[model samples]
Target chain A: MVSNTNELSHEAFLYLIRQSGIDLDTGHDKELFDYVKSVLSSLDPLRSIDVGSTEPPMMFIPAQEDV
Target chain B: MTDVNLCYASVRALSELVSKKQVSPVEIIEAHLQRISETEPVLNSFITLLADEAQEAARRAEAMINRGNHLGPLHGIPVGLKDLFNTGGVKTTSGSRIFDNYVPIEDCTVASKFRAAGAILIGKLNMHQFAYGPTGENPDYGHMHNPWDPEKIAGGSSGGSGSAAASGQCTITMGSDTGGSVRIPSSFCGIVGLKPTYGLVSRNGLTPLSWCLDHPGPMVRTVEDAALTMNVISGFDPKDVASARVNIPDYTENLNKSIQGLRVGIVKEFFDAPLDAEVESIVRKAISHIESMGAEIHEVSMSMFEQSQAISGTILMCEAAAYHRELLKDHAEELYAPVRLRLESGLLITAADYLKAQQARALFNTSVNALYQTVDVLVGPSQPITAPTLLAQSVEINGTRVGTTAAVTQYSRPYNITGTPAITVPCGFSASGMPVGLQIAGKAFDESTVLQVAHAYESTTDWHLKHPDIAS
Candidate 1:
């Protein structure tokens, strides 16, 4: 497991892609890896925030009758 | 009235003409169909045109009006859908090759509501593939061109809705906003686009891009038309879980209301960020114009505004990826390059990362809601720049180069993250003849105030009436 998100290596990134049930053997593999790296970098700062006990963001709720 | 004049008239005007028997619904539909035939070649706004059905519906509307049965404000008006909305027995492609042949068996909630109100469904407009990107460039469906300048882009994934409405191809259109999809196009195309509070409008039959962030709303030629459209399409639908159970108010009731004593907050961070010189000047002039109208203006700040992009980007990727996981595995090759890349990138996000972004979103919403307590509405630039050329991937803003996708949606996406009602109206034009937008947003479920402020500003300026000279 990679502890530091910003420091994720290309090898570890490819390993995670395969683990997610995606085969990265196509011609677009290099491009896909670069995009994954960009996304992970963008998400690095979010990992450090303290969310506390707030509920996860959910846009929809069951009607009152169902509740 | 000439066909060109009828094509550009407001829904309010057209409905009155239909009710008074001065203009038959058949004539209105015929005029629009003729306009579409003339403009479609240059705009590339529509994926499919329903000429035969539109004429048939117009005749029915005419016969009903002839019998003294007036449906209401939207009666006999021709409107367009964003192509992602399911229309019974009509092909809904969603601007992707993956679903090119998929036909829905029933109309979505919004579509059914329009039909119920007597609005004619003219056609389905083009969009970014699966509503993934903001540029409105689709490799599968031909790219939608900006009505203002054919060489520039019409902001997307609701790109076609913007171009069609601006060019008078339709009276009003519907578009979905995940991260500024609706507002971006409206800003770029010089029209009115409103994204109502999260649960204000039901998303039952629309194709899902990001479950939590997706908001289906109105894009029209005037703020009043947007308000009128909202009156017909908004309310609680038991089928849509996100549908708000609160009472739906008349969106147009306060259009003529005075904003004399209203408090308007000009967000300091929005102007402080890097922006095009022309856009910044026009937005400032709009603010000064509103101040001159007797409304009180004050500078306010929200620090969390800076984190909105990352938070919105994360949630959008994860949710969209979850929805398209199976499709990605089976049909990855058929997807557009940028869209497929975005979907696959979601695979790299861990569950922890997704939850962290949601947590950040909750904080951002709290901060924004608290700020509303200090002011009635917030005003800023809808987009930081005008439309860019079709071939350019990035633009120079304030002497620094930035990606087009990031700059186009910078100001509008924050509202989606907070689930507030925000509207974009044409404020002024740039030196180069492109349009600039002024965004006014109010507290959650308070679309009335947003529309009221926008309409007030629009009444003072002739920006909305200016149409692109497409023939040139």
Candidate 2:
């Protein structure tokens, strides 16, 4: 639901990290936030795709009984 | 046999000597041990060297050979495993502080296969921390250096395997390729690395980077050696849920076969991206050489090729994040900076985003497979640039600044996403004397064709014969 790529403020980024159960006070918090933003930005094209009804690459198949 | 250069000898050659009783396994093992002692200080390729156990195994191999018993081509050969693989009693650190004392009670299927083939396990090779990064830089166990030039990176997560294989520390080494771990190191270290089709080799005991993407395969000095090793490792293992139920072919049997009528596809998208001039030239020349040998060369296009890195990154980040969630929660500070950041970033990827990436993966796989219907195999540069300096964060490709990680995995990662078999062979060297690799990928489960093409090119070129000056 990230509507704006540049709108991800430091405060919001830190909130997301905190919500994910990671420590926010760690020295690497900002660095981790920046990296996460970068990865999410790069995946924009894939995120925008309307993969309606298409299954994921790996799917579980149920075993059928012999006739 | 004493005068024979055991350091650069292929598994085939060494096995022949051992089978004929002309060379003792003990002597071969001792020579490698001596060479390791000399080169390991500079390369730092091994995290643990099981000298005593390897020597004892060599003694047993010698006795067996003397009694007219031979296991196979891998018999009496020294092999190294990337530390990510479980080694039973030996420590399987996975280049992380968390598992520094971790040891398994059972050998991975691949390790068991090597043992059954009578190969001596020399030690566990160092790797990128938890196979999370591609640079092979482990803060815990020093960074693995390229044998050709210590200043350059030994392309990693399987970096140590490539260094050991190239430097002749081991006759063959097993490397797990997730996002080009095997091929990147192969290209950088100037050796042959094969990333078999997903599920072709079992991943039962290897540390998981991305369960869906990880592939276990061989890294060796020559294409034939890779093929020989592949023959022993590829099979259906019931223990691995992802293991493919397919007929495993004798990969070495067709290595000498003619590739005259084969159709080789030149992926236009591969070269359209930013690439180093020398790497492009050398790879083009190698492709032309393949055409000169009577293979039909065609230009094939796939637009999705450019988006592979993104798709791969999304998938790997989410999968790896999920696997390491508990560890990150418990020991976040223990991880290397880059890996910890990467794993943390994965926690932010939404489930919808992960699924979308998988959807894109399916589309990409289908498109690439459709291209394969017209071409027997695809050929491209293994990496866009030669090995970057160990300290470099980014490299300039064709006058543009590109991140080192992106450039290193560009050509190889797409194959991993598609879950196809790809092999990197030394095609030529860069202007600075570092090695360049040419990649040949085949249809799913069609490693034989890929090996055939690589073997034909390797037999004609002298690239594989060149070794680093690390021995002295």
Candidate 3:
């Protein structure tokens, strides 16, 4: 049986790397994880958004003023 | 003898004879079945032999030919499918104990395509469990041994397809690559394996390893054979969202296209690293030959090439876990040891981390956009070393031990991340006498140049003509 879908640990994540066949002597596992995590942590690609009652999803039939 | 000549002959040649009535499909299928019965005992490359089905199909093909009904270009040719690829009524174990009893209700996209083209499937080839590892060391199936040396690993997850194709059990075999599954085995087995552009082949009835990374492609003893198989398997699928909507070009039409004026890039960084002395020599020789043939070989550096691999690891593991989560819950006891461990570990990764990895993938893709601008294609040593020993954890190189997956797939996986097409064909062998591979990669969706270069190399060398010494 399975449980606990949340709160995964860093240690656990690293363990998965070894099991995946990427656990090379070059410490590529650590390098790969750290690099990917750092990139993901730094990229702030999107911010919060809100939808209004008057508006539909953008890019509809040419809007006169908002075009 | 296995008629060693016909084992590696092009499918076009075989089809020509079949059409001319010089040879019937019955005779061709009998020869292959006989060869498989003799060699497969030593190689242990097959999971099941569909001899009865194959002969019946061949008889039907003969009937059609007698009535002047030509099914298609691949009419009357025999082929093999990797076990993970679903074939209705045949056991589709994926080389794991988890699905040992499972059979599919529908044939996979490729299998149906082969049938439509009149290609008869001989059997299901063994593979790494759930297509996870590189060594093709399946605990349940007891690993497919390399045909060149019984003690060595055949290389995987396409190991059996490679071994069977190289040994003439089937002239063409289909195997999936999550990371170098097709190309690595092809390199180790000394055959041609082309992992088409990620979405070029339909994924519909094949079991998923990593949805984004798994690519099903053909493995055959020659470049033209691989191209012929590719022509049949490549096209858009309404069922596969990732399937390329682009046109599937006639790969054979350009097989002899002069690469004379083509600009080929040789990664300068790749040469600096110590490789098998013999492998390094063969690759350098291939580069020179291609250069002397009027193609310009420019030594280029893409530091980003080295980092694209990290993105591959992240993306593959996360998606793999997502796919295997339910199986891990219900049948953890049923899964094979290593594959079970692999999937269980994936279940523990958080979704945020998985999403983060996908974000990093976008960045890595951006980083490699500059490489295609400078070079028409990139060429390098397929595997840093030749095939290693079966059941062996690692191999010693230059007084340092490298893990099997690292040494075997280092050059092949980076391209998988970028979704660029790559092909590996035998170039030469090592001093200890194992096959070596020259890997050629082209800009995304440009399999033509990749095939052309491989064909050109095959035309110039006799390495592709050699077969594993499986006769005993």
Best by lDDT: 2
Off by over 4 Å in 3: A1-67, B1-5
Runs off by more than 4 Å, candidate 2 = A48-52, A63-67
- Docking quality of model 2: it rates as medium
Stretches of model 1 off by over 4 angstroms after superposition: A2-6, A59-67, B1-4
Q: Using lDDT as the measure, what is the rank order of every candidate, best first? A: 2, 1, 3
Report each candidate's C-alpha RMSD, comma-separated, in the order given: 1.7, 1.6, 7.3
Report the C-alpha lDDT of model 1 over B372-448, residue by residue, as the tens digit: 88899999999988999985779889889988887887898899899899999999998889999999999989999
Model 3 chain B lowest lDDT segment of ten: B1-10
For each candidate, what's the DockQ?
0.61, 0.63, 0.06
Query: By the lDDT metric, which is better: model 1 or model 3?
Result: 1
Q: Write the per-residue lDDT of candidate 2 for residues B101-161, one digit (tens) a residue.
A: 8989999999999999999999999999999888889999999999999998998999999
Clashing pairs in 3: none
- DockQ leader: 2
Candidates 2 and 3: which is better by TM-score? 2
Best by TM-score: 2
Model 1 docking category: medium
Order of the predicted models by TM-score, top scorer first: 2, 1, 3
